[model samples]
Target: MTEFPEGIESGFAAARQIADAVLLEGYVLYPYRASAAKNRLRWQFGVLVPPEYTAQGGEHSHQRTECVMEARQDDRLAVELRFLRVQRRTVERATATGGFEPVERLELADRVLVEWDEAVEERIEILVPVEELMGEGVQQGFRLPGVGETELLREDGTAVGRLVRRREQVDGVVRLKAEELPGPYRAQRLTAVVENASTWIPRRRTPREEALPRALVSAHLLLGLEHGRFLSVTDPPEWARPAVERCRNEQTWPVLAGPDDGCKVILSSPIILEDHPKVAPESLGTLYDATEIDEILALRTAALTDEEKREARGTDARAGAVIDLAESMPPEVLERLHGAIRGLREISAGTPDGEQPWWDPGNDPAVDPERDEVLVDGHAVAAGSRVLLRPGRRRTDAQDLFLAGRTGVVEAVLHDVDGSVHLAVTVEDDPGADLWRAQGRFRYFQPDEVTPLEES
Candidate 1:
């Protein structure tokens, strides 16, 4: 028998130390790669475990182990092994073989066959190249496998090999040919390809080019508005600063050449309103004449000015102030105002019994002392006993006094034995002690003397 060198022995010892460390943690080892040359050795490492190893029950315990070795003189001369879990049927084959064959020639298959009842542990060993083990003290580095070329089909139904490197030229545009693949598979494949090739690929803009005309028409419509007239194309309002910045950065203009051309034309001239009732002189307004580019330029120059830009900014600020005021109004006030209006409509319709005394035809309540009782419209008063007061010009002094000019409708009216009428009116003013003071007392009016006020 040939004796191994001292260096080879030491290298194998180091490999064993590594295997022991990993196996202590329950890892299994598989067969190692064999050396192609007589003087060298290869290494491989693998491991597997049954599902029971990670299961909850104690009855489902499993086992696993692995080992590795390197030649003493050569670091490259190393070997690794990994054991895999297998089904009872798989184990029976090796047992039935009577353990007569070499361990490497055992009946165990490459893949694991798990048994549900219990987890099983496996052991493995690795072998490294002798030359690498001797020189570097380590061997068997990891490597990824390479992918092979694939065949593909073009959009026109032409089949070709090495599709990844193929390209098609159509109408000055270069594009990749569509390859033959399953529907869902092709979709995902195309998405990945497009993402990877985007940096080097040129995109088509036919849709954008078609939409240019519509965008220009929208701009012209904006130009027709009064607010748009005040703005300058050369110097836009501060509120429009962001849009201007975007246009400048994107360089997305209708026309590219000349200072008066491009998107600036949108702010340069008034959009001639053919259907407008107002008429102007021939030279005053710019017409939509596509034939004359000079006319468009001249009109643009006349419309945009520095003063107009300032006016546009001022209008923008004023609009913002109005919006802020509207938003700040209390929600309760609006609700009350709405309720008041609804109540007034109900009162005007009158109750099913009859109208109130204030609106009744007999025993009408009047402000005049001489007329202790007067007749009023039967439908105008509720139940012929109480009167309703409301704010706004249409309401009587009883409603108007309490509500002031803050528009609302009266909800109810109470009358005392002393002949005084109490009015309940809703207004948009803030609710507080001062609100009542701001509201005056209700004054009665004679039936004949009362006059209906027009709606504001």
Candidate 2:
């Protein structure tokens, strides 16, 4: 198996910068420090480790993470794991070896100065589910039914312990081989099966080299599915820096982020690297739509909530398209998709000026109208006419600032030299309304975005 690439170059300059920020956000310096807690929370994507695994200083002492991959029937997946190890420590003599060998008052352990030596290792595992590769109900890889025990071994190659099976438990009997997938799976998840992996080993100069085994630090994974490349943060090996950047410049980016669960191991949340450093992912409905997830969400939101409809973002013509397609989807799936969309908004919510040509509404000034007249939803409006305010469909700082369905009466109708019409609305609710800024302290809206109210 091979490693994955550092995915495609970012979509645009803004995207590229954002991608790099996500990668480096929580990353800490080598040997790791304690002052910053955010760095310690980083690199949680695609991590898979055994039950009860926890790191000594950071994540897991003997930890690993994985991605769930499924390739086209014609394609395959290549995997590789890379990391640095504290192989050995060089200890200097802490105390002088004087002629006398007696000293109850002095703690000799303080005399040794320890410096660690580092090394690198790589391991590979390839998986092809029986259901996908072979026919259904065919159990070729599984071992005969029997009880199996997890054995602990010492460096001397001797058994130190075994997890004894209980008298009356359904899962007490462990099979020599892991259970096979039930059947016909498009994607089969596989976790690492580590044996006797530990991060720290006690020094034993009195007898042996060390009392335990360990996993290395700053691990990197290069995984390639039949479709694209996948890799995580962590400085590249000195030899691959230029090559790595070259790869980054050519890669298409999709954010792979997760929650801050405060655990040693976590699964990644798929997102688009967004602007705004301080905003958390939970607030942004800025999820990346690569695998038709947006389509799925469109279908699910067909049944709208009263609150959703009240929010101007939900009233757009696009809302209807997502409904009929989603009626049968489960509520849980819809909830996660809702979270994804909310996360997506966090990016659009900010007011940042950059080379974002892809933005829905250009950041440039509004267009001048051809004629001056005041009309809302095709209804003629004059001073003292009460109406409802509909938020602008275009997502921008000005649009977001407007409240949806607000009740207000036209105080005056004004136009500019360009013949652009503005409705001067005085909202009963806004005591601070001023007739200065377009609609005074209230907001100005094009006649197209407001709903006209007749009498009461």
Candidate 3:
């Protein structure tokens, strides 16, 4: 219980804490991007609107997120809403192609710069001599599919069949908004447009121009009981300061500019505190999840600095424990464990409980084989294996041709063109060997049918 030494055992309290954890989990990229890439998928939780929603230019509101809180025995709860609004300052960016003309990609130079051009016309227009679209090509019998908006007729009623259309920008901002609902936490809701980026967002502006935006992506809130000497959701016991401080310091979303104007976005984790005498800020510690910790370390995300780590350890005993365990592991062992665990997790993804996982070889539990790498009595049994057949059933018509408990030398393990594998074996003692084809008369079997006699 390093960080929150409080007795925040209530459901409301725990939810609050988890909200904070998720907000900062992938809020920014490693090395902290003023602009980030789409592939990274940061700001993954509680997303609101993206830039596209704000495309029309004026202040706009979009997207709604509702958080429902249960009423206490007293039927009241105090919840403080908190989050960051990334302020996007409009600015111009240019293309290396010089102008919009189609130019070879290689011809573009990096030195070319252009200011953010607002109100750029998206369509081109020209006057033609004909009443309808026509060209010099074959005419009388050639059929043409018609196109264009209903011809805009002149005041004289003559039609100008010229086409009108729109072009897409290589890059531009859209509407995005995330606002808290005005009602109580017990039934809170929100409303707005531009809930999330319709398309994966890339670095669309200069580092100086890139914004966190005013949205719910960085929201944090705390909801707890108000009666029986309960503290405000906005305030925590003095003992909890250090834990909060460490969290902001490590996550490091510096306030470039804002009313409070600080680097860190501050908010308490959501929680439900109660009237119990045992509960207090100094006694609170967060719940631990080993699986989540594994992912955080594997990502090697933020909070890695020695100072940050120390601060984190001071606040979270569980985090410290896992950090220590990971730090103490041998590099090679750690790598192997991480890789194998990651792979296993991938195989089990979307799998329901009690079913054979996708990674299980042969799709059968009767033969539990670990195939990525197999170790058999200090040696491997792969190709050219010498195996003994298990005593098993043979149909009456096939009884004389194959024998059970017989030794066989594995020949080429053939793979079907479609990638199915079969262990090819030749029974050296087969009395009918002369009747079968040459090459020692091989037989194919599933991996479960043959047991390795010994390492070969």
After superposition, which runs of candidate 3 have C-alpha atoms over 4 Å from their true positions? 1-16, 31-42, 50-74, 87-212, 225-456
List candidate 2 segments past 4 Å from native: 1-20, 24-269, 273-371, 382-385, 390-405, 410-426, 435-449, 453-456
TM-score of 2: 0.25
Residue range 1-456, candidate 1, lDDT tens digits: 223344433433433322232222211111101111311211111111112221221111111111111112322211222222211111112234332211221211122111111112222123333332222233222211222222232223532111221111111111111112233221100000000011112134233222111111111000111011112323545554343333320111111111112221111111121111121122222221222332342334234343332322222232223223333445453343232222333346365575354554334443322222333353343212333333345444454455333432333344555565543333334354245535642233323323223334
Q: What TM-score against the true fold does each predicted structure earn?
A: 0.13, 0.25, 0.26
lDDT of each: 0.24, 0.34, 0.34
Q: Report the C-alpha displacement of residue 95, candidate 1, in angstroms.
A: 22
Worst 10 residues of 1 by lDDT: 188-197
Q: Compare candidates 2 and 3 on TM-score and give the better one.
A: 3
Segments of candidate 1 deviating more than 4 angstroms:
1-4, 14-18, 27-76, 85-456
Q: Candidate 1's C-alpha lDDT?
A: 0.24
In the range 1-456, model 2's lDDT, one tens digit per residue, is 423222311112223223333333223221122122432333332222212233322233333233233334454433333332223322222134422222222112111111222222333323332234332311111111223233221224533222222111111111011122234544333232222233233333322112211332333332334442222323333443333343221111222222221111111212333212223332212222222354343453444453333221211112222233344456565565554443343355455575433343334344322222466677778777788887676736465345787788776666654556777666667656653435345456667766888884
What lDDT tens digits, residue by residue, belong to model 3 across residues 1-456? 112212222433445344444344443332222222431334444333335444432212232212222223332223233443332212222234432222111111211111111111111111111112112211111111222222121224533122132212122122112122233332211111122233425353423223223233443333332222222222334543333233211111211111122211122322222222121232122223222434345336333665444533432233445445545655565445343322333333446776655454355444422232223345455555777765344423355245567887666554443545566566767776646536445576655656777554
Best by TM-score: 3
RMSD of each: 38.8, 22.7, 24.7
